[model samples]
Target: MKCPKCGKWSLMKFYICKNCGYKIDIKFEELVKRLTSENDDIFVSGMRDACSYTHSNKFYGVYAMEEAIKRKAKSENIDFYEPGFTYRSGIEYAEARSELLSLARKKGFLADVHLTQELISIWLAMYTHLDFNDLAEEIIEISKGLDEIHNFQLLYNQMHDTAVLNNNDVQRE
Candidate 1:
């Protein structure tokens, strides 16, 4: 079941959420697994949160992304019922997707994450503004592990593109 507190799916035996501790007396991890195995609304919720958080975090990229997504969706004649994706669009989704992943990234979620070419491209686009040195050690570790652990060769290759991932881009690490 969706944890009322953290909104994550939990194992039937798991009374506490790993992401955010929320205990429900109900034994329901199996149900959570079954539904989330296919899909879940939490992804959508996180998407919306990403948009709002990005807008609040300060910058216009998310806003611009929002417009771009809206235009693309419209051009493609893809109708969206959810406001989070359609209303917020690019900026918010990007921001939310990344931001929601911040903790996961820090905790090496990318290792467990199914890395794809699309994901690498998105990170490259979003983090092109980021410098290699500015990256957290954990982030660096994850980057390196992308190939070693996950065998994400596409991601590994793109990560070497100095134009986007570099040491001098942000003046931090």
Candidate 2:
């Protein structure tokens, strides 16, 4: 296959073009389908491993999981349950997942399960909705009872950096 931009011929099976940084013989739709669905569990596990290894940046893993969920939802035609608001039609779940993941990437965390579940509790009198801050706090609290408390600062810094980088990328784009 040849690089469309530079017309470079190479025998490399799959690679970005070295000559002009053009991609050769690529199928974006197929790639997206595979990343989003095929062997999804493996992808999720990879993201989880990345998170575990880095220790400071779990948002990447979270984003990967979110993407997988979005893809599955889109493929299955599942609608996100937005409490109180009428369900929007023709909404692509993968896009929604991307949006949520982007939000988390910028904001530093995804909503914890409990907070996400409690979004319907209007009587709780919470002005703000559930979000990543709650999750970070929970992690910190849990670490206090374990041997991992020493590394909480690193994780916090990583979250902050990730948010900053995501925000910068958005502004630039």
Per-residue lDDT over 22-136 for candidate 2, one digit per residue giving the tens place of the 0 to 100 score? 6643443233333343343643344344345234432443333333333433332322222332443334422433343343343322223222222222211232335345534
Q: Which stretches of model 2 miss by more than 4 angstroms?
A: 1-50, 75-173
Q: Rate the local accuracy (lDDT) of all candidates.
A: 0.35, 0.36
TM-score between model 1 and native: 0.23
Global Cα lDDT for candidate 1: 0.35
Candidate 1, residues 32-112, lDDT tens digits: the string is: 222222133542332343234233432222222232233322332322111111233476536643542463345433332
Alpha-carbon RMSD, candidate 1: 18.4
| lDDT for residue 163 in candidate 1, whole number 0-100 | 22
Give the best candidate by lDDT.
2
